[model samples]
Target: MYYFNPDMLMMNGSKMSFEEKISVLREQLASADAVVIGAGSGLSTAAGYTYSGDRFRKYFADFEAKYGFKDMYSGGFYPYETMEEFWGYWCRYIWINRYAPVPSDLYGRLLELVKDKDYFVLTTNVDHCFQRSGFDKMRLFYTQGDYGLFQSCSPGGASKGRTYDNEEMIRKMVLSEGYRIGDHGELIVPESAEISMRVPSDLVPVCPDDGNLMTTNLRCDETFVEDEGWHQAAERYQDFLRRHKRLRVLYLELGVGMNTPVIIKFPFWKKTEQNPNAFYACVNLGEAGCSREIADRSVCIDQGIGEVIGALGV
Candidate 1:
């Protein structure tokens, strides 16, 4: 195992020894009161939930020819003419991300490292990896929607007013035993055998009380659902911040990118700048760096999360 040392600081263009980086991280961890983990797609990528390659081919090969999308993200936005095709792709996506085991043990290692710390996670990843890896569900805020949820579409009093019973959706999808046309010729079931289970364009998911179109609880469009659960999680996140504002908090950012700087980077920069007792650490394979203002309290380790977690074996 590599050990970090104080004199291990290297120039920007120069390579940073993993041992030295680990030592620095250990020191930061030792003094941290509350650890806030900010994650992105890169964290999932490290765990082997890659958007393309064998995983994508296995689930979406059929649609690739028709839509030319190589990954699930692009596939989500693909203009499928039928709901059957759309649901077919999404069901597979949800199954793989929500039910399947990721390629690496990175999430588990992360859980182990933060198990003893007063920690909270704010992640944009929709895969539910942190919970699967044994992190406390209450301590996590999945800022984005989950793969296992389905919502209703209705113009509510909010900018995006939609609601869903995620449990019901998961149960229905899993219990349908695979997508098949019902007696009324409605697609319901897994798309493994039948790729024709398209969600109807007119299909508005209704409240059990009122007939309305159902939608996913995803934060993609204006109709994204911001239900009570979302607000509660946001409150928990705020509470965590307020409780640790004056403590030595460690803002550990992993695999975050510029796609949503406001979510991860901007907040990290602001917090570290405001709190003298705070430190910011970022670990990204290729994209790793921090502003000079927080240079003394920041460490941008240009390494894969899995490798770093392994080096920090709990």
Candidate 2:
């Protein structure tokens, strides 16, 4: 059974009771012509893909000892003295989060809930859980960079952004004499060597015309790539909005935080405000509140997402 701390509940005022919230959600689910799911870090948390604990220690014990980072998210932003260690941590992160099955059935349940509907997902999460859960790829948009994808720093350069083929990179890393394998099959690298290692000059992605180190397509920096796929996805999302402008659209937002309101929360608020027919639903553990303008049409379920999904039987 999943546990929830009462302190995490973020309902600000006496709104609808839990039954009312569930009733409204069921109503919205039944009537929505198109369901748009906006997801954030919380969704993955529900799926048991935490950034710390056994998983973190398994892949990042060395990084933690050397850099003092306690979690994967913090580690990602930590300023490691060298790119090698950074990439090493990131590669392992991508490998596990992207390739490994989630710890729970939460993602699968989410997919089941929306499978029968005309649904599209817009998520800031890079974990690719939706795809792994069997959601149609074409119907989902991962606004943030994906862990599995690598973009060239210069697409046309000789070493232009090539998706770091995981199998290839892992093969190379394992073959390189630099990595140390423990008896438990854990991989380790020397802290000094990590600092000296660059993301291989050759590996640095460049434009097809000019070789440059390829970078993760994440939007954290100016180097984030906006390739053809990005534009196409944006167009599809826009088209969805345009076509469903007058329909009973349901914007089901889950676990969106304030760190990047523009991506999920703000858009949900704006879109719901613009469409009288739209019903905005937010299911966040500790941050489940919405504007008064749409409050009558909103259902803020301040509870654990896993519990919510379980209740839905999705």
Model 1, 106: alpha-carbon shift in Å?
A: 1.6
**Cα lDDT of model 1 by residue, 1-314, tens digit:** 11222222464756567787888888898889989999999999999898888878866777787778788789988776655556656756676677656667888889888899999999999888899889998998988888766665664544244455454443344334344434532334344565433444333235553455455667887767766777899999999999999899999999998788788888887898899999988888877777766777877788888888888875
Writing each residue's lDDT as its tens digit, candidate 2 over 76-150 gives 888867556557666666656776556678888888888999999999998888987799988878887777667
Query: How many backbone overlaps does candidate 1 show?
Result: 18
Candidate 2, overall lDDT? 0.73
Predictions in order: lDDT: 0.74, 0.73
Model 2, C-alpha of 252: deviation from truth (Å): 0.2
TM-scores of the candidates in the order shown = 0.84, 0.82
